[model samples]
Target: MAGSVNQQQAVIYCRVSGAKQVREGDGLASQETRCREYAKYKGYCVLDVFTDDMTGKAASRPGMQSMLGYLHMNASKGSEIVVIIDDISRLARGLTAHLELRQSLAGAGGKLESPSIEFGEDSDSVLVENLLASVAQHQREKNGEQTSNRMKGRMMNGYSVFCAPVGYRYEKTAGHGKLLVRDEPAASIIRKAMEGFASGRFETMAEVKRYLESQPAFPNIDGSIRQQVVTDLFSRVLYAGYIEHEPWGITRRKGHHEALVSLETFERIQARKAERNLAPARTDINADFPLRGAVACADCDAPMTSCWSKSATGKRYPYFWCQTKTCGMYRKSIRAEKIDAAFAEVMHALSPAKGLVGLVKTMLHDAWGQRLAQANTIKETTKRDIAQLDKQLDGLLDRVVESDNPTVLW
Candidate 1:
């Protein structure tokens, strides 16, 4: 129904399911073309064209909100105003949205029109609109179901359904589609970290974190790798070439990607982890000084801490200082370079020569032989104790068979 050509003004509204559809295709453009042609045929003067790239089932959208505000602004005007859409499904796909939107349009004093469906002010027309809205809602719900199913299927096929881990990056392979691949120094660093923990090179999760921070190539959050990040990396099965997700009901399945650490090594790391629930927690020490707890202050017999001193020239110099203020040498700054050189000298002195190394090995072998001889003696004593216990048990059984006393028999 066309109003007077000179008196009527209209706005075109269009929408698509998602931004991906808009970018990869022309869904919005095609919808606009169809609506414009229909508006021209009816002699309606087009005022503005508003568009949205979002689901039709959603009642709140950026473009739709703006268009509603515009409708309210022109509601009191005496001129005839109309809102045109490509189809009713483009306006909304849910029954609740359909009914609510119809009321909202009426309240704004705006009439709705579409090229495919004729607008009528009668009972039959309202029934037809409601039927169409119900059908659209069904389609929207069915599409959601299919999408969820596809994601579950992918997860079951040895592919990660979630984001990739630290050492792996996602890529689209030639024939494999999207899959995970090893990512640079991060991968090598993580491999060393895991293997270190397994071999006792790194004793605790804190040690693992320090190892990662030492590597410049490894990514860090806020200038350090968070404790949670280290904990998650240790627990992930992807490093062992497996996948497990609870929400999707997926259990252990071999992954398509290569593994960084061996399965046996992963088990060792888990076994070495501290029983946090039972033991008193370890206090976190400042990691800036690796020798913080190891090296003792010569003056006070207390551990020293590392810090920096700012000189008059505004340059910072590294120093090791005692924290105990009551000590005689408290706050005495020792040059870090001197301490490092002294440590190197001590280590060099401790290195054994070839002849002394052989001497030590011979002594170690004699000590081991003595330990084995001692173990044999202990085993013989243990066997004698077991035989005596058995003899005592046999005597008790004979007494029980011969006695009438209730105490002994019972």
Candidate 2:
């Protein structure tokens, strides 16, 4: 009977909370070692070792599922396989998950065994197991809370603790552990794009997207810049040398990282965004109908829509039509050829006469001269404003230096 008991089959199960532990720590390996030692001490035949790198609170784990299937496959009428673990927490962090896995293992003909705790059918043993599982759950939750608090504190001190946005990467600094720094050509490209938008050079978000697409160094998904990314860039204050986290109650404050654009430019970008005209370029406009949106519907004054219509005899005809539901000519189609000829006639009608070319040139020269004078006046005004702001900033800095209380100013 002793020899038969010693010949019982067993499998080892080990787990860690995350992939970082699996890659950088020996938690899983050490757990497996301790479990194998226990199995050897019990004289059980070790069949396999299963490991999972995931949270214990998770109901289903790939390694756990595989071990269960293996146990069911090898189980015989009178033989049961022993499942060995280093500790109960390695099995599950929560009482509910522990109980569910316990039932599943028993159904698969696996007898639970651990080096740290002895498994028994008694009510007292089940109570101890449940208490330990609950403790493990509390520990997991506590750890999460501590980590969040630390990150929030770091962000409060003008350090970004979250993942770095595009054009920036994390680098280890002397005082700051991981700090955001400009990441090469992509940063330069983004700086130009943002400044262009802030200065009204790129009038619309569609123009910005096109500009980004034209840059060879800019990162792209499937060889195209996404509209959503452009939108996010416009609203992110971090690019303006400030940090803000509404969820953590961190208000806008100066960050330690170098800024790509000035706060003034960022504010201007926001002001322009309020106009609510940052619509993306329509993908439907193609070479087949170059004047689709350029030409207005005479009936409704809305841009005409273009499509190819198939006739009963299987012939395709390109046409432009008004799509405004409230218009009288809502679905009235105009032949593409007729519209093209009419547009050509209009262009001819509006063409400048040869005799008036010199007069038009002189008028443009005068307008250019006026613009130069206006720009000079604006430049002088901006200089005075900058000097006043500098004076105010100096006064604020003096106050910060005189104050000894940390909580008061912050």
Candidate 3:
């Protein structure tokens, strides 16, 4: 029984903040050495080491969670596990998180040990350990608050406080914290997308996505062009002359950076987006052509529906004809075969008329441009009307107060 108990081992958990910490000072290796020495002195064989280079304010860390899972799995099998950290702060910086981890470790029938602090079944030892943990938590909170204040100060001074957005690279400046601007290939693609959208070459966001996916320069992340990226690129105000840090709120800060496109162009793109949202939906006609909801008969104004019949050779045939009997139109069902052939003949005939084709294209383009202009005009008119209504409302209220008429004011 004693030999079996001796076989139980300890696991060392080490962590550091970033790559710089690991490269410059006492990091994973140093922590491991200390933990191993402590375990040896405590008469426990070191089994494994779990390290995480992330903030300990959260317990959802990969290494920490994995270690907990390992402890739970080994707990009931007569395997006594001791989780050793360099200190309690290495486990978690937050008091709540530290307490939660302690409860979890205790519940799992595992013990947490640190060289700096000792724990025992006795009340005095437990109290001392808890006090040390609380002190560590306080230190962590102070450090976090200091760091946050520094970051906020930097942001207020027109310095970026976080990572640069895609298509832009961050350069650290002496006086300014970080400067951001367009990066190669990505910048070119962004410019192209903006120009394409502005020039009406790309009619919809989907068309823009398709164009981006086709280019070797605009490679998709994770082998697919995400719809969100395209939408974000189009809507991002940073690309234009203005910068909006927080959208949909009053806490927006205008960034101090060079604009990639004009403010007018940006507004136009936003208007296009608004127009698309307001556009009437179109229905597919090819699949349901003969159905009442699909095609409208030119003469009778009734829907053309499809029907099946048998030929003399016992072969199946389909035809579309007018449903209204009282209407002065062809009563006999039009064979699908003859209609398809005639449609093809008409299309072929039209294909040869270059002048007509050019006229149709020009008319369609002009119609689209006119529609956009009309939409803009309507929007401007609506804004003016709203402003006028607000003025009238304020004046009416003022008059009501001056007249001392409670009913009129209400």
Candidate 4:
């Protein structure tokens, strides 16, 4: 029996829930050391050590699977190998996962052993193991709940607890834990895109997509930003320095972070999205067909569609024709040159009269004078307000310095 025990081989398995444990603490190293010590005490030869940096709730672990395969391939003809662990909880924190792994190890010709508990085939030993597994499972679930509650509580205090959006990144602050701060050129680019869309500079979301794709700094998959990403950017209220999470029951509230765009601009974007059924501008609308949609058919009054007609001689001619099937002149070709000349003539006729031009300039001059006067008045008022605020601030500082009474200061 002693000779057989000396010939037995053992494998060490250690697991930690997260990378932080491996980095900040010597969890895996400590577990392996303990397992190796146990193997030495049992007089078993240590074959190998496997480690996992993953949650115990998961049944599939790379290290665990590799160890199982090793056991299957290396078990001697009639001898079973011992699998050593620091504790049962190190194997798995979930009851289902523990049971599944237990069965898997047995099938792989591995007899489970841990320094904290002894493995046995008796009914009493099995019951104790199951109870311990259940307790570990409860601890994992409780830890998860506590983490979630803390994160939600921080979010309620106007701090973003989730991953920072594209335009922002989290920074650790003294008073406020992790707060969102503007992230450089990306923030500037996104601000311009959102403001442009709100102000009608970008007539459709397609224009916004193109604008983002043009910016080399903006992240893109396959050289183009997805339409869904642009939509999500516009939908996020976080750009306006606000936090909201519908799933967490959080309502829109002002955040500590600086806003990329004003609240007014965000509202404008929402209004524009609700008001328009925007579609991508046709790719064919270019210098060649500048009047494609602007020019209408004389018979149907519907906008004309332009196309280049190719003759048998292999020469192309630009023509504008009505696309409306019910129109009397539907598909009736009109020379684009003729349309262009007529358009120029109409524009000339629409030009302001010489006398009206002078009158319009005079009116604009008067409006400019009025605006200057209003601006000057606002400037003086702002100066006075700033002086008053400075005075009040000085008074408060004086009080704080002179008075030692904590109650009065509070």
Backbone atom clashes (below 3 Å) for every candidate? 0, 0, 0, 0
| Residue-level lDDT tens digits of model 3 in 1-410 | 13245565778899876667877877899999999889778788776789888877776688888888888877764555889999778888776787788888877757888897776879898787677767877887888889877866655555556666656778766766577766545665677677666644454677677677766545586556998888988887777745444532224355666566777777777876764321112232234333323444678765555556789999988677765666676555777777677777876886556588789899999977855765665567669989999999999878987886567755
Give per-model TM-scores.
0.59, 0.64, 0.59, 0.67
Which 10-residue span in candidate 1 carries the lowest summed lDDT?
A: 275-284
lDDT of 4 by residue, 1-410 (tens): 13355478888999999998989999999999999899889888888899999999988999999999999898865689899999999999999999999999999999999999998989999999999999999999999999999988877888888888898988988898788997756787799899877765565677788888887667788788899999999999999999889998999999899999999999988987775432344333356777654777788775566778899999999888776677899778899999999989998889787799899999999977855765665567669989999999999999998998988677
With candidate 2 superimposed using the best TM-score fit, by how many Å does residue 219's alpha carbon deviate from the native? 3.4
**lDDT scores for all predictions?**
0.79, 0.84, 0.70, 0.85
Q: What is the Å distance of residue 139 in model 3 from its true position?
A: 4.2
lDDT of 3 at 103: 84
Poorly placed runs, candidate 1 (over 4 Å): 1-5, 77-80, 162-169, 183-236, 260-274, 277-410
Give stretches of model 2 more than 4 Å off: 1-6, 214-216, 278-410
Better of 1 and 4 by TM-score: 4
**Residue pairs in collision within model 1:** none
Q: What value does the lDDT take at residue 62 in candidate 1? A: 90
lDDT of 1 by residue, 1-410 (tens): 44464656888899998899988999889998998898789878777888999888878889988888888886565664688999889999899988888788777767899998887879999889888899999999998899889878988998876777898989998866789898765777798889876764454688778778877667886668788988998898889888778877999888888899988888877876743321112233344445544566898875565666799999988687776667888778898778878888998889787799889899999977855664664567569889999999999899999998988866
Error of model 1, residue 144, in angstroms: 1.5
How big is the positional error of residue 175 in model 3, measured in Å on the Cα after superposition? Answer: 3.4
